[model samples]
Target: MENKVNRNIPDEILASYDYQPFTSTDIEGMPVERVLPTFKATTGSNKLVDSLADLVNKTVRDGMTISFHHHFREGDYVFNKVMRIIIDNGYQNLTLAPSSLTNVMNDIVVEAIEKGVVTNITSSGMRGTLGDAVSHGALANPVIFRSHGNRARAIETGAIKIDVAFLGVPNADEMGNANGMDGDSAFGSLGYALMDAQYAQTVVLITDTLKPYPNTPASIKQTQVDYVVKVDAVGDPEKIGSGATRFTKDPKELKIAEMVNNVITHSPYFKDGFSFQTGTGGAALAVTRFLRQAMLDNQIKASFALGGITKPTVDLLEEGLIGRLMDVQDFDKGAAESMHKNRNQQEIDASWYADAANKGAMVDKLDVVILSALEIDTKFNVNVMSGSDGVIRGAIGGHQDAATAKLTIISAPLVRGRIATVVRDVTTVVTPGESIDVLVTEVGIAINPLRQDLLAALSNVPGVPVFTIDELQQMAEKKVGTPKPLEFTDRVVALIEYRDGTIMDVIREVKD
Candidate 1:
């Protein structure tokens, strides 16, 4: 059943589209201002609901789309509480559009699907049992997986309109001014939820701590909100960073980090006013340590550091090594605290961070960005969405968006125990080969041939060895041997869309 004709098109062509200016109008040609009535009241005197059942009965209805944010990471409780209420109320044809679905959300979502309470889902990613269930045709319709930027664009352009946004804030005022900075459940940078506050037809601020009116430095402005509901507790703050941020104690990971720092220092963009973004993993965090010492030696200071804010990145800002910290999300408690105190630590929504349709975003200003990869191909294409077994286990979060930087550096070990990081091709191409500028492993650095300027610039750098990407791939294969081919079902579990909304790749679920 293999097709003969070539349907694959060039990425540039796929990304090219006429830039049409947007007006304030809905899809049906009515003025958006008229369609969505603005709330004029300064405050609502409705008594706070005691339970989720009461909240759902007051806000949720049949065939409506509700949304939640994933700032609490693995410790999120609001999503489950809200979904259970909707299920108990017998609501059907509901679309669950959370920012992302973690392992904890899988069980309840499956039950909701079984009860016919939930049918459609759109999110940045899904993992664990929920992904497995969806892949097995658990629902009649396919799930739509979008990038963080694309989701923001979808909401603003009226493609995926939200009926209600149930925001879980750490601190809020009785008048609906809220932020993720001040209470027991504090999680910094209410970046993702800021978009929901602006676009959702109705926004309910659900918080564990409710302060008095006139909450200053409001992350969620009171003008955009319609209601405020207080709860017993939103989430456990200790679990906010959970698995997202960690310092590596593994020797192998440290070796990879050292190699990554060597690659960065030897690159052309290592001079003053350079910009970069790093992940919150063990090895990735170690890279920052190396980079910090290198910067001190070379007398270089970065203009700004961008992405999900980690405590290490925030430390750079505090130490005057980086001029600004442009944060779209916070990864740890230290970062969450810094956002509250530092005036230079600016909080921005996802659209301003990476949306391609926007006039200009922070990604466009990046000089270099250090990223992680689940699997990389000889072609330099990356797979951050699927695992070696073809299962949906990872997220697309800012990976492709930051790949558009002037220098995109991916730091990963060549192999992890038995699995090779460098394969013939990736399972899912979240980032195309053209966008990746350099690949660094523990053994050596590989400069993309397309980036001849970088290869020429780093030719004589001391203490660094450069090699062809193919040579590194061969070395890894020689050590670990080629991995067995993964078996996948024919059904498409998720569609990977580029920032421009084109189908970059499609991932099929792994066979059980």
Candidate 2:
């Protein structure tokens, strides 16, 4: 049945998850409840364990839900090490929940799924071989993909209760107090892992570097922990940002980014002390470079920058352009290193970053946010989850959460080979059009009609050509010649949730 948003979600699918359709975007000051875990009182001295196998034996069981954080990204070692132990010990029917899965985790995840060790899965996103396996129906249960904020919300609401969480930090103490900012393999904030630590029945801290009894400035405190295990190495810090957050020199991307700067500089929100967030992509990085010159020329300084911190954003902070850098996850070594030296570069957890239930999130104060889209429609709906072929290739991440910004701009090329970025309807609606304020493409810019003030603000502004979203779609179709519609089966592969925990869209299995 199609709900108020005119998005067709199957009735059975809706009933399975007990989800309601997205109706409106008015979610201001909504009170949120939390799910607290009950821990058995233990006045024991040291929580140190022997090995990964020992920790697995102590905490994990058959048919239980276990989690890990992806702060280490492709460099993470804890997931594979723990899963190997679980598989070796003959654990079956367990759920593998993580902040997100990277390409490096594909083989282990596939092997675990094939061996019946992991029967269920949930995360922000999955990619590479694991995504291909899931799309081809590898597991008995469908994967549940949520945005970072929604994942935090689900963990807090007890919708997805965790039995054990194997969190790896750069530094931790004997009692399991840990943070991601110190030691050799530092990956910055333990934002995504904080929810797991607070809620998981059993919390295990695996670290390469172990400090003394008390690890001060602990992001994951000793109170929330149950055991600590030492490891030779947690991850490779250099590969923490593989396949994402790279500088781009492509002419098309540069052009799109140049237009994005024009939209921001001409908009009403681009002034002194303005706050903003930019997504990770070649185009977004290029926008930072262009926007830096604009800020220098206009003599405007931003109040702060939010979300996943990158080197370019950190460079702005070091240059005294942005006052503060609220980091939830570090994208590169520069970002991780900056957190160690700079006081203004603060580390924040996922809840404080974008959790809808929190008193206030950093995204709420955002004046402008530039995001990338896999596909966007005339309604201004965005899809960062799947591709034109209906395969899950991306994560919701903080796309929906950051769309609450005053000026939300999606920067993308008009066409990628034969794929049209702008279309009549997106493959999936990850972020609703109601919250989106602008769509910035290489050819032109489309301002949401609801924001008449923005349209008027940039209407006569030089170098910014404002057009209707429909016109942008038509322009894309003309370039791509209206590519054939993707084929999909009725089998639901994944469920896309809005930031408020409602079912906005569902991904069907791709046709064989």
Candidate 3:
């Protein structure tokens, strides 16, 4: 039994998550509802627990929400290990909320969902077999997808109250003071997990290394945590950034990156003490390299670089080109290692990183942000949450929150294989067109009409062709022709929430 309540969503997309749509400008703060927990009296001793089973028995119950973090990316092992324990103990109808779900956690999640050990999920996104299962309506509830910022807002607002948070840190003391920048399994920046620690009813710290009491510079402090458990290993450090963040020798990506650099250097925001954010993709990473040369040539320094940090961003910090590195999550081993030695590379939590409901966020101060897109429409709306086929294949991860920057630049190719990236309408609208200012491609750069200042600024820039988003769409269609429209079912599979927690869009089941 599915129902619809409209708020100006397209007819092709259905809202079946009991959703209420609002104007994109409806970003005012709202009241929160929470299921608060009471704490037992303690006598100021170690909060160490014997095993995960002991931790679960004491804190978990049926129909409760549990959470995990993805700082380790594909190398994460905590999700499988803990879910296996919960399943074996026969905990039913529980909700699994994590910062994001990766391919490594897919099979275990599938098992949990099938056995009635889990019934609901909310996360940044899911992929591979798990995505397929959810897209086909294998669960009782539609999976809720959110941006990195929205997840923080939900946790804080008690929209999704976490009963227990099983956090994996590289090192922790007996009293539960932990950080991701130490010991053998260090992955760097416990930014996302810090929110869980601060808000969850019971916080469990799982670690491979136990240091002495009072670990200094703790990203997760003893005051916020409840128990500490030791594990054989938390994750594989080598796989932390195996493929996502890498240098590209591809000529096409380099051309797009160079064009982005030109747009930034000519923009009014590229001055001394300016701040920027760049993602961890081939072209987005290449933009950092190009910007570094420009910074040196112009003798300008940035105030800070923020978001899911990479090795190249760390390099800019080390060379004094960038003043500070505010890390919410680390993308590579080099970045993880940098947090240990660099005092200027500060660790921050997800809420402070991008929660739109908060008093303020770091993104509010961002001058320029370079992101990658799976698809973009002539209206400049971007989709990072699904493929051209309408399958749930991508994550909303900070795509909307960071777009609030003064200059939002999306780096993508004109065409991916036979698919045109610039379409008349996107398969999903994760980030509204009003927030986007420019799109950098190998062929040309498209400035959103909403951003006339950017148009005038980059009009005569040498070596970079400027075009309207409509022309870019025409250019892409010329090569690939109009693609066959993807077919979708009436059953809504997932709800995509904006950074402020409104139903901006929903994903429906794809027709076979």
Candidate 4:
């Protein structure tokens, strides 16, 4: 079946999952029927478990769905620790439903798949060896890739019912109250884990640092928790943002960042009190740096900033350049530490951050958003999922959710090492072009024809070169030549879901 994005999703696959193909991008938010979670009744003060091995034995069952969070990013240790116990305990056919999978989990997840411990899997995205394994059909079922927002929506609507949620906290009490903003392994807000804590059938809180009985200001409350377990360490804080999202010194990246700032300032959305979201990466983080100066020079202040919190963004919040930081996940240690002292840095759960079913999602209120893409087509559709070689190497993240902003700018280079970043068509469409507004590359910028108002507005901005999407594609092809078409078998490996809970595209297994 061909979706609205024109991607052919196999009918058999759709029937297996009972999911609808991408119909329209204009789907509106409706009142959601929240799925009631099954909870075991227990009245006791002794909710603490001595070890993960004991916890897994008590909570995990064969063919059950289990979940975890990626707040610790690449530094996460809880996942491997829990999975080892489950595999050793001889569990099989369990569904792995984490908020997202980080590379640190690659080896174990692959092993689990091979051993039939995790026969089913779903998450926001995957990369490295795990991605390679999934692409080659390592798991029994095709992996379901949902955006963060969609993951929250799936949980809320019971599309993904988790039997156990193994949440790793930085600080937790014996009674199960916990928070991720304290202790040595603190990685930031417990945004991704909140939904699981509330909706999972059994919520087990794991931590290295056990706080006092009450543990006030708990991000994961005692009422939501079923058990608590103390470990040696939850994760290493330093690698939380892949060793902190640092400032870029690359000249090409900086130039692209400057162009992105120019687009924001010249556009109608850049004003005294506008809201915006920006992704991570050398160029994307640099936009925050460039936007900071623009905000200072124009005497403009952003009303609020959204998405993964970064240190540069925290600097803006502390310096009063931005009024509030609505953080779902913190990207760096500085951002995580700032939340401890700054009241303005509010912690938000995944659903509240970007759930499509939530009418008042933070993403819908954005005036502008700066995003990154692996490749963008002439139609402006963005592919942040699979790379040029038809291998999964990236995540969808907020690319689709954040595209709902008034002006969504995609900042990417024209070519990356003889591979054109701009193509006639993306290898896969993660975010449809209709939602995109502008494409900012180092060589030039291209406004989506759908956004003619922006084109009229930015056409004459001095030093900001304007070009058609076709021209940018031409320049890319001129530099790198046309890329070879990827060959794939009919077997679907993964489903690229839109934030609205519809199938946007399906990735087939690459032919050997």
Model 4 Cα lDDT, one tens digit per residue, 292-396: 999999999999999998988999998999999999999888888988899999999998998898667898799999999999999888999998889888888
Error of 1 at 417 (Å): 2.0
Question: Lowest-lDDT window of 10 residues in candidate 3?
Answer: 1-10
Candidate 4 or 3, higher TM-score: 4
lDDT of 2: 0.87
Stretches off by above 4 angstroms in model 2 are 29-31, 242-247
| Residue 183, model 2: Cα distance from true site in angstroms | 1.9
lDDT of each: 0.79, 0.87, 0.86, 0.90
Ranking by lDDT: 4, 2, 3, 1
Across residues 269-316, which tens digit of lDDT does each residue of candidate 3 receive? 999999999998888889999999999999999999999888889889
Winner on TM-score between 1 and 4 is 4
Worst 10 residues of 4 by lDDT: 237-246
Q: Model 4 Cα displacement at 64 (Å)?
A: 0.4
For residue 183, model 1's alpha carbon misses the true position, in angstroms, by 0.5
- Quote the lDDT for 271 in model 1: 95
Model 2 / residue 31 / CA error / Å: 4.6
Q: Mind giving the per-residue lDDT tens digits that candidate 2 earns over 317-372?
A: 98999999998998887888778789999888888899887788888888999998
Which candidate number maximizes TM-score?
A: 4
Q: For candidate 1, write residues 441-501 as lDDT tens digits.
A: 8776788898999999776766557888888888888999877788877665566666666
